[model samples]
Target: MPFRIFRRVLQLVLCANALRVYLISHSIRRVIIATLGTALLLQVAYFASVLLLVWRAWCNRRAVEGTSQRRRGSDYS
Candidate 1:
């Protein structure tokens, strides 16, 4: 348990130092940040498109099912 805590503390210190250096160095940070941002934007766009398609498909399936159910009930009456 003690060793685990020590490892975590060491990792935090290293991350803080790296972040400070990244902030101090403008050019490298900008390129890294821009690439990450673009990746996130593209992910959001892809997710939205997939969700819209699934929603349309669900609605179409429900409509078809509802009509078939109505037709079956009418024939039995």
Candidate 2:
């Protein structure tokens, strides 16, 4: 099973490399432009997702801290 999986993955890598070569040879300019656009969009999406997750985590942490502070204040009283 592991050998089969490795063989399949290797095949896919070879096929992808062949297709990349063909694309680059066919129209390098268009390929470069498209690749850059795709990379930029991917980076923007990744950063936005990360920022949103961090914001949510920060909010949750702040809320937990606020609740703990209230509990401590009540305990002191």
Candidate 3:
């Protein structure tokens, strides 16, 4: 009977250890996924900022060209 009890205790210990390992692995997987998500968001933001800068530059060039054209028209008049 004592041997049987010993075997039961050993089984319980093994089960508990397995549960702990599974939980740890699950948490690690979540951390990795979150990190990847953050990296992707940052990449998207960087691209957006670059696009905004290009748009601003284009607008400024157009404005300058328009002013220069108006000046030339006035001079002709």
Query: Across residues 4-52, which tens digit of lDDT does each residue of candidate 2 receive?
Result: 7645765565456556855668876665665566556655765787799
RMSD of every candidate to native, in Å, equals 10.9, 7.8, 21.2
lDDT of 1 by residue, 1-77 (tens): 25577457655654565566577775766656655665566557657877998999999999999999999999999
Worst 10 residues of 2 by lDDT: 9-18
Higher-scoring candidate on TM-score, 1 or 2: 2
Off by over 4 Å in 2: 1-26
lDDT (C-alpha, whole model) for all candidates:
0.70, 0.70, 0.69
- The positional error of residue 34 in candidate 3, measured at the CA in angstroms, is 0.4
lDDT of 3 by residue, 21-63 (tens): 5577767565556555655665576578779989999999999
lDDT, residue 45, candidate 2: 67
Reference-based TM-score, model 2: 0.63
> What are the models' TM-scores?
0.61, 0.63, 0.65
Better of 2 and 3 by lDDT: 2
lDDT of 1 at 7: 56
Instruction: Name the lDDT of candidate 1.
Output: 0.70
